[model samples]
Target: MKHFAYISLCLALCLLFAGCTRTRISSFRVETPEAPEVEGVHAYMEPHSATYRFSGSVTISPKETMAVSGSYVNYSSDSLMQQSRSFSANGYYEFGGSDVNASFDWFGKASVMLIGFGVGYDDGIYHHLKVGFNTSVVEAGVYLGLYHQYTTLEINGSTCDTWPCSERDNWGSMSETNTDFYTNLFYGLYASIIIDDFFMSYNLSIYNPSVSGGGESVSSPDIYSHYIKGGYRISKHWEVNAGLIMSFVDPDYRHFAANVGAAFYL
Candidate 1:
């Protein structure tokens, strides 16, 4: 099938560019390996259901991570489905982390469809603040943020995914943990372009974390993360995407993942 071939080509390209660096088909992360992160644009350029919208997506990185994210948007009072100006709140809760990882973002866009522009804040591990501009076909942005890495102690327990926990609960556990935190700074740039029903995006980020002990602080080696993705819209309310994600922290600490995802608009 054409879709199968497309995915195969993507994987081959990822392997080719990964080079001789130690590569694992796993989630990419800056700090905790257990907390694999997948980042990308979660919305489409046009064909929104209304001025006020809700959207959700699910992404899976083969042998790596799976995540679910959602967004809510409020368009400018005078606008309709095609957002000329809007504000949005987004968030995700993911599995495949040490335990689990959850984060949120707030974003605003202006002058969309023509020369679009936006600013946002992310409470994720990297790139907490972002600003970007877009045209009808192209988009670009940069982001910077601070993260705290921590060593955690967990004992005698499990994790929960819902409120009002019950005995017959899935992924339920009794656990307690404490963390010792260190500081990290991250900055990144991303670009995306859309043509017809096809779109592609790329993100690159650098992370630097520091540890303090014995009255002295030492900085760790910088880590670089990359996410490249391409997708096609199948219908007005549905789309499918596939991409490659990678991170480098020297030759011995390289990580890669290939992901596929779908988004729905409402």
Candidate 2:
């Protein structure tokens, strides 16, 4: 019953937006490299421009939910070691709960190939934040990002539902579908590629929250997610993307997701 409702919501959003976008990964080797000098399948590519992207996704795991994401990129320039920067926001909505995040990054400089900060929120409950850094080198025409995230989920509760399985306690005020609150420090990696009007990306991220309630610390197991997306430009300013997301806490708690979205260049 709960899964059905979430699925319905995700479908409705897809119909409403008919839009596209994907999460941007940091790569020290490239800042959207310049399109080939020759014209053909990759002629529409532009290396020194700005863009805004948006996407919608569905989580198919411990529970079902609808996730939406958007991002903004600043035009590349010669200043600050070939400067490139971007800001992004994303969220997931399920019955009785939601989780959202905002992040920013600046790259194109060797001394600081990748610098980023982000914040996470679960409706009006726990508060969370993270900071990270990464560097990458081009390999076989793709740029990979090597990064780390330090995250903290802080709230007054000693108990809450963390996902993997189900909640065991009736802990006061904890919604049946809220992301577990905890603090964690972990590393991850990412990759991206651009070919003319085509684009693709992949990411593997880590999350583990440690919390305290009743003077006792509640430690949740580590969570990992694998994400991949592909996109194609349909016009000078618009692109459509689709991908899969897999997340796991354990063999007993693994899930899959699919997403579709668009990107708009400015």
Candidate 3:
């Protein structure tokens, strides 16, 4: 749609004038470690069409990261288009980490989808809390919480999506698994701003994980991640979004990704 194009153009202009280095970093060697998931801002700006919502997304960081995630939500009331207080319960799952991560959330809001807040827990990994204010054209918020970190290693075999690949002569299967050696607790901060359908967010985490169990003690660097996203509501029941995610692992490593997603209301 025309609105989507305008949003996309705005994002492009922002990136172009950001004044960061233009060096082309190879995506294959970048590692995200315990990167956080992308948060949705459009969900806070408007009412849903129905009491149930389902959403899914795919993200690719060239050769570095590939992931899929899904979520479901159930509202307590039948009609949610009016300005009233309500409650909802939701579940989310993702297959991008060393192992799968899942969580359940309970949300309470006092607005016609214009201003809201929620608190939830993340399956022993994260404690979630967020609050936001929204108007017809702008939305802003902050999310901060605690999370547990794990020491993990991932290995992958040679693989290609198409047959008879020109990139390599040999075709092999790919498998990824991780072993957790220790765990540490860290604090995370997330801040976001949205204008119309375009949004931007930043995440920060800084902590040192002391060695526990059998792994040798090592110092870890701080993590910084951010993204710019744009979405369009095609109908009351459907919305589509696309964005870029960039995560820096401090010191010398970073991960860059592009994602596309859709949400359905029913």
Candidate 4:
């Protein structure tokens, strides 16, 4: 009951903050680089900006006995635009020294990341044209991270649960597709609220691709997956962020992770 209420409150705050944008602002970062006009590509980049980065996150998933991960994120705003980018990696290994560990530990260092570069437009809109990739010596693939934000919101949720989990077979297998590959390429809108250097960000994403035994195919409409991340700033260069990360897909994975990092000027 508390989880449900918290989610509702977060959504309300997001709606409230999203309406807090100014009709006419004095200035922004980055300039508009002219492009051939298109329907959904109406954004421009900002040049002068401040960039904040999170070093990495250590995550422990249910697949291996235990694993560790790291990530890098940069949030910046210039004279014309505000943009962000992130990259992450993880490695898992079995617990208790084992004689047959060599064959299994070989699958330790599997990772993926989103290299997102987008343009911020007027009226608090942005487009994320991102590049995603993963490689493990034998097999490798690439995909696009298509994301857009059209609103802002506030978030408040639980911080007590330390470890989250999914079903046994819900790692990343789709039931309605025939593709031998899997990746994260979600599209959605996000809302956030910032007050006195404290912020709450919530996002609702739609996974357009559903898979079966064969490959990826267009299927029925999915559910609204939720993500809420909030934190406090300790100084001009550092902040601590933590929250609940979950999904609403067939093979869903839920977990709690936090990051303590810094923001740098670029």
Better of 1 and 3 by lDDT: 1
Q: Which candidate, 2 or 3, would have the higher TM-score against the true structure?
A: 3
Query: Stretches of candidate 3 above 4 Å error?
Result: 1-34, 38-40, 43-53, 64-107, 111-127, 145-151, 154-178, 181-217
| Local accuracy of candidate 3 as per-residue lDDT tens digits, 27-132 | 1111234344424345443443213345556666444433312122211112222122221211111123222333333333446432222222222255545555
Residue range 36-135, candidate 1, lDDT tens digits: 2323344444432222222233333434322212222221122122332222211111222222234334445555521212222222343266666555
Q: Highest lDDT: which candidate? A: 1
- Residue 171, candidate 1: Cα error in Å is 46
Q: Model 2: how large is the Cα RMSD against the reference? A: 22.1
Which candidate order results from sorting by lDDT in descending order?
Answer: 1, 3, 2, 4
TM-score of candidate 2 to 2 decimals: 0.41
Q: Candidate 1, residue 94: CA error in Å?
A: 19
Error of 1 at 243 (Å): 1.8
lDDT of 4 at 195: 60
Please write out the lDDT profile of model 2 over residues 56-98, one tens digit for every residue: 2232323443333334453222232333355343333222112
Candidate of highest TM-score = 1
lDDT of 4 by residue, 55-112 (tens): 3222222322223333333221121122333434232212111111000000111133
Question: Candidate 3: lDDT of 240?
Answer: 80
**What number of clashing residue pairs does each candidate have, in the order they appear?**
4, 12, 0, 37
The TM-score between candidate 3 and the true structure equals 0.47
State each model's CA lDDT, in order: 0.45, 0.36, 0.42, 0.29
| Model 2 CA deviation exceeding 4 Å by range | 1-187
TM-score of each: 0.48, 0.41, 0.47, 0.32
